[model samples]
Target: MNGKQDLSKVSVLLVEDEAFMRRLIQRMLEDLGVGEIVLAQDGGEAVQYILNNSYAFTLILLDLEMPRVNGFEVLKYLRSAPDVGNHDLPVVILTGHAEKERVVQAVQYGIHGYLVKPVSKADLISKINRAMTKPPIDASHLK
Candidate 1:
């Protein structure tokens, strides 16, 4: 995409439990020229970091399966938490499997998009572009 240069201003919050996967994705993002990337070990850590630094991110790449808190809980918090400023913040799920029920649940909770495991840099860029172009999801009704 022509926006590779534009990615220099983007800040991404990547939430993944697996260290190897996390590093791999981070490196890809960096290679794509994302300006700032923050790492969270799991949903629990991601939530805490978001609570304090919600404004620091332009996008969230979330992993559903986690040790604690989990992606769904974080999605609930983002969509319903009174303290959250940007309820419509762009979110992309980084999932290993695209289960029907899980996808439905995620959409109901308001994810912008999702990427299957073993993400390619091209796929990552495409998802990010699509998510950014779309308007924010109003999942307040789901609360």
Candidate 2:
């Protein structure tokens, strides 16, 4: 994916537990020309937001660990919930570790890509473009 592609139409739902990391990524996305960015402090907040407006965002950047609802649970809800209007919504995991096991597990839930912590602007652009342009993963089996 080209790092220069315009992203003025993209909207992202960013769900992270840490305040600092959330702010950092939000700034990165803003600098990248993303049209809208919604912040969710944790996975629980993300779930509630999704329940009410699942189709509003173009993509989701989700942290794997949290206090109450984890990224895995949010992924499950997004992929399997009967009420969600857009089951194929693109998701990218945001994790501190890139362990093979963890990445593999996230793949089962149909994550588009992942970013290691302290994400670079270039890597962020690439992943977002790749995720948005790729065909949606079929998660009907999650139902």
Number of the top lDDT candidate: 2
lDDT of each: 0.86, 0.87
Q: Estimate the TM-score of every prediction.
A: 0.90, 0.90
What's the distance in Å from true for residue 140, model 1? 17
TM-score of 2: 0.90
The alpha-carbon lDDT assigned to residue 35 of candidate 1 equals: 90
Off by over 4 Å in 1: 136-143
lDDT of 1 by residue, 80-130 (tens): 999887788899998998886787788887898889998898889988888
Poorest stretch of ten by lDDT in candidate 2: 134-143
Q: How good is model 1 by TM-score?
A: 0.90
Give candidate 1's whole-model lDDT: 0.86
Predictions: Cα RMSD each: 3.5, 3.8
**Candidate 2 lDDT by residue in tens digits, 1-143:** 56567888898999999999999999999988899999999888998888875448899999998888999999999999998877889999999998877777788888888899988888889889888988643444333
Q: Which 10 successive residues of model 1 have the least lDDT summed?
A: 134-143
